[model samples]
Target: MDQRNALLGEQFGICPICLKPDPEHVDHDHETGKVRGVLCFSCNAALGQFRDRPDVMRRAAAYVEGNVWKPKLVAPGVYRLPS
Candidate 1:
């Protein structure tokens, strides 16, 4: 088994997400909530894409809604995307 995975198995006792005897690492975002998982890399990515910033995700949901958004970017000195 992988070193980190084994360490997780020995230390954490179970993967945080799977709740299985699988190994896991503690993950967290500097600007977000508790690091939520003891699963593999793929699961973490899925959670990030799904749960983080749901409003922005809703805006992205436009294509699924069959709506169109104009690309009107005002004087760009550097701006954040709408949420």
Candidate 2:
């Protein structure tokens, strides 16, 4: 097997982060163009969503950890906080 496929097998065809089986996408460094590892589509999308910034990712984690928003029930199937 080639290097990419080999890495995919090593990772068991699943995303290391979310541990979900998905078509493999190679993850790499945008700056230096260095190959990092293989990841699933969703996990790869997450890095893009975070703009590949560790600081932004950390802030998002902190926000989730803070749990600043609590769900409020509005209707049978609708739930939202009042503005």
* TM-scores vs. true structure, each candidate: 0.32, 0.67
Q: Candidate 2: how many backbone clashes?
A: 0
Scanning candidate 1 in windows of ten residues, the lowest lDDT window is 21-30
Native-referenced Cα lDDT, model 1: 0.58
lDDT of 1 at 67: 70
- Per-residue alpha-carbon lDDT of model 2 for 1-83, expressed as tens digits? 38988887888887788888754789988988887778888888999899789977776786789845567878997889523
Which regions of candidate 1 fall more than 4 Å away from where they truly are?
1-12, 30-37, 51-83
27-61: candidate 1 lDDT, tens digit per residue = 56637655444555654664577666656567767
Using TM-score, give the best candidate's number.
2
Query: What TM-score, to 2 decimals, does candidate 1 have?
Result: 0.32
Count of residue pairs whose backbone atoms collide, per candidate:
2, 0
